[model samples]
Target: MDVDNGMLLCPTHDALFDKGFISFNDDGSIYISNKIDKREYELLNINKDIKLNFKREQLPYIKWHRENEVQ
Candidate 1:
């Protein structure tokens, strides 16, 4: 995999992401899957306000992940 295809995340968030419970918008904001209950957001420490800094080259990978992995 290309380095740009990788993102550094905490174990909890990483697992959530890998499980398709979360993704990200092109603007870098977090995209929580509807499959997740609203209450779980607080329990998981996730919120709509969260965002990551992404490079332009990473957008394509992000798009692919969102399409294929995210619920």
Candidate 2:
């Protein structure tokens, strides 16, 4: 586990993110969670076109998170 290969998501987002229920694109755009209820957007802050502050090096980790952890 590389320390710098991690994301800075909030606790809620982190849980989903790590499990690949949520993810980000190569350009750092967020991937919405299908499992999460749309009505709970305000509580989870789910939004379209959301860009995370990620560096290029974090891409591999992001991909791994998406591919290996997706439900």
Candidate 3:
């Protein structure tokens, strides 16, 4: 479904991003869905310091994912 609006993410992050369980900012700071529990996030063992590299063009795609698919 991603076509031109895609990036190469690690499997965990990729799935999470596609499902809208996670997202990235223009600054590439990662954010988890508020629906996710703290314990669950801790158990996932995602890197607390990880950041994605996003370009301006990707904003619309990411926004569409967040607005339409995100829980």
**Whole-model lDDT per candidate:** 0.91, 0.76, 0.76
lDDT computed for candidate 1: 0.91
Residue pairs clashing in model 3 are: none
Best by lDDT: 1
Model 1 lDDT tens row, 1-71: 78999999989899999999999989999999999999888889887798899999999988998999997
- Can you list the residue pairs that collide in candidate 2? none
- Sorting all predicted structures by TM-score, with the top scorer first, yields 1, 2, 3
Q: 1 or 3: which has the higher lDDT?
A: 1
Q: Could you give candidate 2's per-residue lDDT for residues 1-71 as a string of tens digits?
A: 77768767788888778776788877888777678777887787777668877777788888877777776
From the highest lDDT down, the ranking of the candidates is: 1, 2, 3
Clashes of each: 0, 0, 0
Q: What lDDT score goes with residue 71 in model 3?
A: 67
Off by over 4 Å in 1: none
How well is each residue in 1-71 modelled by candidate 3, as lDDT tens digits? 75659888878778887788887666777777887787787666666567877878888887777778776
